[model samples]
Target: MQTSKSTTRIISISFFTLALLGCQSAYYGALEKVGIHKRDVMVSRVESANETQLEAKQQFQTALQKFKSVRQFNGGNLENIYETLNDEYETSAALADKINSRINDIESVSDALFEEWEKELSEYTSESLKQKSAQQLTKTKSQYRRLIRAMKNAETSMKPVLNVFKDQVLFLKHNLNAQAIASLKGELNNIESNVATLIKQMNKSIDEANQFIKTMSQ
Candidate 1:
């Protein structure tokens, strides 16, 4: 009975592996039909990630500006300030989510591309060509690791800033009065520092991404 079960499992595994390979072959074929390769997809994903970081930076800056503007609220529609703060919080949260998704997409394509590159290196007939390709693969992989580390570091830096923003937004939401405004004023300096740090990390990540893209293109 155990032998039969093992045989059944082996067959199932073989079928699944064949199906996966067939699907991947079809996917690559379609991509080639449109002049898109895995390398192109990876580059595009990196660019998309950079763009998302840029957008996120802008959104955070806008939120900070709005927060500062609210500090000067001596009178008039407090509701407007609340609405703006809430909007900023929601928008920033959404941008963070998008940035994270872009990072994941980049990672997915990167793993597939690197795996394919490694596998193809073994298929090269000429020793010289294989050696060269292997060196290039090693270098590319090293560069990619650095680039991804920078990107992930930047992504990690954003969390604390976002948390602070959320807390302030929630506090203000619950206490929409002069006291709340006064309390927020106390947090301004810390928020500014966190935002600055976040922006620096983002800029570093962007530079790393651009460098990686240029290297890959070469």
Candidate 2:
């Protein structure tokens, strides 16, 4: 059983690589051949997206701390500060991009699953069972709407935060002096507010993901 599961995992991963490269049809076909369906893909993608959001939350928290540290700068080597801040900005941007990609992946899988579910409803010969399954699909679709909206809200919130980070980094690149640090100090409050809002939205998105995962498990 272990070896069988391991082989399945390898095949699934290989197919996922192909899927990521714009071969989603092939990916779904391969998975279906292995007894894996779009519903399973949705569950897996949601789980991954949840983990990625958690990671982004932590990364943004660190960025907030870095911003705070820069605001309190009474330092000698300001270039070192610029370098560190630049690195944080780059990492945060990369994370924002990753979260967006995950959101897209979740949407893709959800679309395929829900479309298949809606289509398969007609295949049921028994009316009562068909009605029940149809209602379940409706409920699941509603929950997914809430989840994706929250995910998108969080994903969009990252942009303003990234803009602030980028502006500060660019400003410091040309003017690495006390005056530049003073300017950063002025913008620090806005940065804090934006990061706080971003974190709040991420928490909401994460909570939605957890609820969706429960629905999937059921």
Candidate 3:
């Protein structure tokens, strides 16, 4: 009886979570009915993506700091250090995935908005208004093109830093000896350089997102 009750509770929680998520699309659709369309969603998503990049930049900085701190280890159990580094890698990878997901979301909304705009253009009675709408669409699409390219470049930049972190963490995990520590020290400079590059790219991408959001809002 207790086991059945626990299973039922878990299932209830899962269903509640799913229901909350389902409400998000419904909320957006509801907004559209009142004329708040996908363009607004795109602007909001770009802002969100910018914030995520800022957070991810800080995370990589923390990971770099942790990597540098490994040099101070004199003679103690290295398990904690390994665990911390692994955790950083995991967190960074998750953040990267978030950035990618945000990019996809922006693309999805942009596609929907563009398609709807094109269809509406065909239904327009005034040729002048249709031309104006087409021009606006082209301008918006150009801005989006620039924004997405910047974001993709930033996303591409994350992989090298992540790879370095993963390599060092896995090395330490298997060896867990003085030699492994020395090996990490040798890779520290390279890691620092990669993290610096990543920070620069993330900042540039954040700037692009900000610019895009501001323009879209206007």
The alpha-carbon lDDT assigned to residue 12 of candidate 1 equals 97
Q: Where does model 3 exceed 4 Å of error?
A: 1-29
TM-score for each prediction? 0.86, 0.88, 0.83
Name the candidate that leads on TM-score: 2
TM-score of 2: 0.88
Model 2 lDDT at residue 136: 97
Give the lDDT of residue 187 in candidate 3: 94
Q: Considering summed lDDT, which 10 consecutive residues are worst modelled in model 2?
A: 17-26
Q: Model 2: how large is the Cα RMSD against the reference?
A: 9.7
Tell me the tens digit of each residue's lDDT in model 2 across 1-218: 35798899999999888777567777898999999988888999999999999999999999889988975677788889889899999999998899889888998888778888899999999999999999999899899999999999999999999999999999999999988899899998999999999999999999999999988988
Clashes of each: 0, 0, 0
lDDT of each residue in 11-100, candidate 3, tens digit only: 999999788656755777899999887888888889888989999999999989999998998978888888999999999999999999
**For residues 123-192, could you state the per-residue lDDT of candidate 1 as single tens digits?**
9999999999999989989989988898888888888888888888888788888887887888889899
Candidate 1 ranges with C-alpha deviation above 4 Å: 1-26
Candidate 2 residue pairs that clash: none
